[model samples]
Target: MAHLELTGLCKAYGAICIADRMSLSVPEAQVLGIIGPNGAGKSSLFNMISGDVQPDAGTISISGRDTTGLPSRRLAKLGVGRTYQIPRPFGGMTVFENLLVAARFAGGLGASDARKKCGEVLEATELSHLTDETAGGLRLLDRKRLELSRALVTDPELLLLDEIAGGLTDAECISLVAFIGELNKAGITILWIEHVLHALIEVAHRVIAVNAGQILADGSAEDVMASKDVREIYLGSAEALA
Candidate 1:
């Protein structure tokens, strides 16, 4: 069975439908990248899959278990980890402390185990040197790394990333892409919703475009980007995405 599956998922707010019978299946450890125009419902889709929003219909399953409508906290405990577009670290906490909390709560580890896991995550994210720094003091790139570290501390089977590379320098973006590639190689199933097209192309094995609450295209990264319809829909924003 696929590690993560969404079958005929639908979500509507009154007359406005945000997800229209969306369906997808991701094999274990696959890197799935989602791209589209501004109102593509990409973030909404992440929210639904991460259990932050309840779908009006259809099913979300992880490892053959129905997960639709489950709360976010429950999803976290079920081995689903996620990062937002805007990083939200605990402002007063130190870098290691932030991940330690996630390890203990989300992964159900005891204090010592949580600390060990936290150390591992900090190393993986290249934040070990800043373990004592306050989270609020991090720059944009480091903050993004912290977001990723927080998710990693959960030892998640599935990782949902929503525009984690939205604002970064070209060098920083490249580094982030390389790190994510390494993570995927280490067996983490990832679904990344990103406007950063170049970064996605570097990491994702498959690319999909979502528009107006539905998937518009799905295929190899090159093929999806070359599709005429995708081009027409996102003509002006190509540079930003790239």
Candidate 2:
């Protein structure tokens, strides 16, 4: 069965339809990459699936169960985890504390289980040495890592990452890409919306481009980016892909 599936999904803001009878299915452990220009409704589509936005029509299913309109927290308990385009860690809390909260509330773990989960996550994310540091004090990379680490606390089967590599240095983006690949190798199904083309192409098994709330192209990363329609959607197409 598909890990996540959307059938005839529809959403809109007044006359601007964001999803027009869209149907897609994501199989387990597949790293699907989404590429599109800003305002192409990529994030909106994610919001609807993650339950931050309700669709005007259609069904969303996870593991063969109808989950349309389920709230974000409820989805969290069902093994759906996502990270925002921006890191929103609790500034005053320590790294461990932030993760502990996610493990307890998001993962629904007991006290001991929560602590253990936090410890394991911190180490896995390579933030163990900074476990006691205040989140606000972290530099950009560590803060981003914390955001990713918190999402993992829920032990997500389907992970939604929205521009997780945005605003990072080239070297940092490379590192993050490798880490994401490792997560996928360990069995997490990833649906990533990313603008960082080079980094995305390195790891995604398949890529699709969305334009005006519809799929413009779908194929291997290079093939999709090479499509004439996709190029036209991106300003200075060749440069955009580069």
Candidate 3:
């Protein structure tokens, strides 16, 4: 059975359709990469899957059990952890505190386990030294790190990352991508929407290109990037990919 599956998903706002009978599936422990244009509905799709948004019509199944329209908190219990394109850590809480909250509530861990998890997460995200600093005081990259940390502390079996590599330096991107590879290797299923194709390609086992909420292409990274439809969606940037 697919680890995550969406069938006949339909969503729209006024005349704008973000999902048009879209269907997709991700196998266990596989990394799936998604690429699309600015308004191609990539983030919206993420929202729907992560329960930030609900589809007007569809079925979302995890491990063969229907889970459509479940709230983000509920999804969290089902082993789904998601990061937003924009980080939204609790501004008043310290970096470590924020993670502890996620570990306790979202991860459903006991106090001792939550503390240990948050400590490991802080170190993993390179925020160990800033554990006591309020989240709002951090720089953009640190906020991004915290965003990812919040998700990781949940110990999700399926991880959804949205533009997590967008603002990082080249070196930082490499490190983050390598870390993601480690997560997948550790048996986490990953669905990542990335504008940074180079970084995504490093870890994604399969690639899908979305255009106007439709799957424009689905195949190996090289094949998907070479798809005529995908190339047109990317426009002149195809030359840059050469």
> Can you give the TM-score per candidate against the true fold?
0.93, 0.92, 0.96
Query: Which candidate ranks first by lDDT, i.e. highest?
Result: 3
Residue-level lDDT of model 1, residues 80-109, one tens digit each, is 999988788998999999998999899999
Question: By descending lDDT, how would the candidates be arranged?
Answer: 3, 1, 2
Looking at candidate 3, what is the lDDT of residue 30? 97
Ranking by TM-score: 3, 1, 2
- For model 2, the local distance difference test gives 0.89
Off by over 4 Å in 1: 236-242
Q: State the local distance difference test value for candidate 1.
A: 0.91
Better of 1 and 2 by TM-score: 1
* TM-score comparison, 2 vs 3, better candidate: 3
The candidate maximizing TM-score is 3
